[model samples]
Target: MHLSKLFENSNKSSPKRTGETRKLFLKKQIFCILYLEEHKTIADLCIPVGVSIPTMTRIMHELMDEGWVTELGTGESRGGRRPVYYGLNPSVRYILGIEMTRKYTRINIFNLQNKAIGDTLQIDIELDNAPGTFIELKNHINQFIKKYKLDKKNILGAGISIPGLIDKKSNISYTYPNLGQKPLDVVFGDLLKIPVYIEHDTKAMALGESWFGLARNRSNVLCLNVGYGVGLGMIMNGELYQGLSGFSGEFGHIQMIPDGELCDCGKIGCLETVASGSAIVAKAKQMIESGTNSIIRKLVGGNTEKIKLPVIIEAAHQGDQFAIELIEESGSYLARGLASLIHLLNPEMIIIGGDIAPAENLILDPIKQKLNKYTISRIRQDASIFISELKEHAVLLGTIPVVMNRIFSDEPYINNIHNFNKS
Candidate 1:
């Protein structure tokens, strides 16, 4: 879509040479929606939105009058009077996103600008595909909305992220049994009485990083979700790469150990067995239980059963040699898998996101070093690897784009505003 085309915003505005002017409702609507992603002044919006200063000013005024835009003070002075900037009126709309993984489920509300509101609700519930599971989740959503005092009408929609196999075509999770009986979007939409979109947890992480974090505006990136399970979200040609059945990006299942350790998928020696959060905790527990002389034992009060990924990471941070070795081992395994990815995709960037990313150099440094050893020099040089700055919030916040895109696909924002004005 050459959506960059602008239109004249006023009757007296001149026609543009290429892209449309802001005068067309469709042009102005899309441009304004893009601008809501970040604050901007009329002049700042011209080139990208393909509108002239006068046209942009007129469109901005229209949006402001409709309660979709607001003045956010002025930018730095270039010379005389500083130009006033504008941002989205966050309260005009809200989106909810829920991220469910093997270990826990996190749900939160966000504004158009991707700023989360109120404290995030995180529960230790594992994901299940049974009808009762969604019923329980729907109840939670109701309570959360009531607690926040959010009017149901103001909430536009919701986004849900889940781990494992998801068939986007049928909206059934192959990995989550009992949900294949019906289409998931319809099920959730009916329960919530609002639109709902679903995506893979790793895909949600990739979208979050692409929309609000490190991968913004970049094409051909690889986002590795390094959490309890290792997964990948591939952005190809500036879009998500979900192959047939929407079950792509299972990077962890690539065999590395060759009958090393049995995986939860019933596969032996998958990369996840050696490189994921579960692997990290399992390895730490093994070392402690086997009397490997690690401070993790002290952190867990000598109870190996109590050991978790965080305790081991803390021990590594405090200079525990055993913990450091364990992390390095996992990083090495991860690098082996990423090395394969780099050789095949040669992505512009490889982003490390999710829970364990907080460990930073403890794991990242080793992964880079292993990449240097495993990946071709030319390929490794092209892909810049880094940790996601959003940390734990990436997946939960991905709902903003998911819900917004769903709404945008159905009707133009101008029409929605027109309907809002009528009521």
Candidate 2:
């Protein structure tokens, strides 16, 4: 039976569906809980949904038969006989995750257990909003599916995380205003012939950190994506806070160095202009070109153009004082902007991610030093800063929750017995 049938046929209401609707709601609720918590006994599951033991046992049997749930042996016995534990069937379906940045794109397939099936395929596809960009992306997705020999029927959906201002209610990307203003999810969905969901890259990163990385179990957090351009993803009050229009965390554009440098966003002294990867590289290149004694020129083989964030970080690691100073300067400016956030949001954890994350303490130390001077001691003490452990994979892993949330929200329970009736 195709899972799409369950989602597509969920909304038809009739007197005959009264009992099925209630049952479907319960089944979905149980599925969601098990998806998050993994294996659980019928008795354990019943406590959350307020369902009777007998009723939950019956539903669990039905789910197992439907291939949506599986019995994973037994748990330790507290008394008498041991209890059986159930979890989502890992082989039942798959999810496609696509993480796009300004310079490249990555694609991978994930199973129901949130594990990647194969190596993530990365390609150089610059996201410039050209008409050919989507076509190129669609072609790669097709190739990835064919390469993996994935069953189209079993592929549940695709989740895309890209740099843009995505409107939550309309699901439209306002940043790519020149690209006909179509919702990115719709375009990808039509091309892939599967349901697709879209999310801002940094916001999705925050979701990944919240679910699988260091931000887990932490209520208030700030995920800073210190890539070519800096961006922020905020987790406020235990939820991913997407402000009105899903554009809450535009941390890069905040003014920092009054009349210092012009930003690509048509602003002067934006935080990105001073503290982003691009800014670090630009500073390194200017310093090298000025005949400063540094190993960065040798690392880039005399090509200043090749001196990117990684090269600068490598130089800093190799005891190059010039490179270290550049990173420290960037961190200093970053701390100034973050100090304001500390005073305002008072986040519990600030996660630094992206290309600069590999520098680790080199960047963190300077930011910590500056935070002391700029922020109130009491407020700044509440937020602990650290590099993201998820690093590059955060955007891809983030796609999981983005797609699942959309799936569970819109899909309802439909009485389609023929699809699942296996006697």
**Which candidate number has the best TM-score?**
2
lDDT of 2: 0.85
Q: Give the TM-score of candidate 2.
A: 0.92
Over the stretch 40-85, how does candidate 1's per-residue lDDT look in tens digits?
6677666555557887787678767767678999988999789887
Write one digit per residue (lDDT tens) for candidate 2, span 174-277: 66422556777787789889888889999999999998999997989999999988889999988899988898888999998787799988899999998999
> Looking at model 1, how many pairs of residues clash?
9
Model 1 regions more than 4 Å off: 1-66, 71-86, 130-132, 409-423
TM-score per candidate, in order?
0.83, 0.92
What is the C-alpha local distance difference test score of each model? Answer: 0.78, 0.85
